[model samples]
Target: DAQAAICMVRGHAAEWNISADKIGFLGFSAGGGVAIASTMSATQMERPNFLCTNFGPSLMPVTVPADAPPLLIMTSADHPNVAAGLVALFMEWKKAGANAEMHIYGDGTGPYELMPETGETTTESWSRQMLQWLKSKRFI
Candidate 1:
């Protein structure tokens, strides 16, 4: 079902005048699995130029392609149940020789807050940080 997003992106990438090469996917929580599935899927166009998971589980036994796009994993120390998963994912990507970066926010309190405004709490500032990450990837 999540791959539908990828399919939709591929279906409309050109019509929308967006460069497919600049395409990327960002997902939160369970949506993170979708983003991973999209990137790991066989269809090339569905594989975004970048894959980002915000406070989501880190995938395992995934065969990252040689051309795998940069991967960004964001998590919070407050969520002990999921914190280690992100690190596992980072290591998995590195083991597979994929470009990866991770940002661990918060100080052992609070939850993952998506789409935080520019001047909110540390959890809220995640969205803003994502923008900077995009720029660093030269996608902006």
Candidate 2:
């Protein structure tokens, strides 16, 4: 489904005024697992230009592809299993020489909001950090 969505978006890029080369995948929670799976399994034509997973860890074993898309992983340090899984994933990506970045916020668990509910916390800047990662990768 994720690959199909990429295909669909690319197919309609001109009509949507979207840049086909800048297409990316971003998922939160369980959806993040899906995004990773899609990238791992994708053909070159089906792969997203980049991937961002927020508070989501792969539910299955990970084997980083040599051509894996640039990855951005964000989760809370206190989120135990999730934090550990993402760290492992990051390591795998690095091992494969894939481009990857991660942020584990100390002050919270679960997903962080794009904007803070109370005073600002490091976690609240997740979206901004992701954008920076994307820009650094020249995907934006």
- The number of the candidate with the highest TM-score is 2
- The CA lDDT of each predicted structure is 0.75, 0.83
Please give the range of 10 consecutive residues that has the lowest summed lDDT in model 1.
Answer: 109-118
Whole-model alpha-carbon lDDT for candidate 2: 0.83
Q: Distance (Å) between predicted and true CA of 104, model 2?
A: 0.3
TM-score of 1: 0.81
Q: Report clash pairs, candidate 1.
A: none
How large is the C-alpha RMSD of every model relative to the true structure? 3.4, 2.7
Off by over 4 Å in 2: 107-109, 112-118, 121-123
| Candidate 2 per-residue C-alpha lDDT over 2-107 given as tens digits, one digit per residue, 9 for 90 to 100 | 9999999988989999898889999988889999998898888788999999988744578998888889998887678888889899999999999899988775
TM-score of every model versus the real structure: 0.81, 0.88
* Candidate 1 residue-wise lDDT, 1-140, digit = tens: 55667668778889999876787888887778777766787477566778889878644446667677899888887776667777887887888888999988765444434424334665557777888999998988
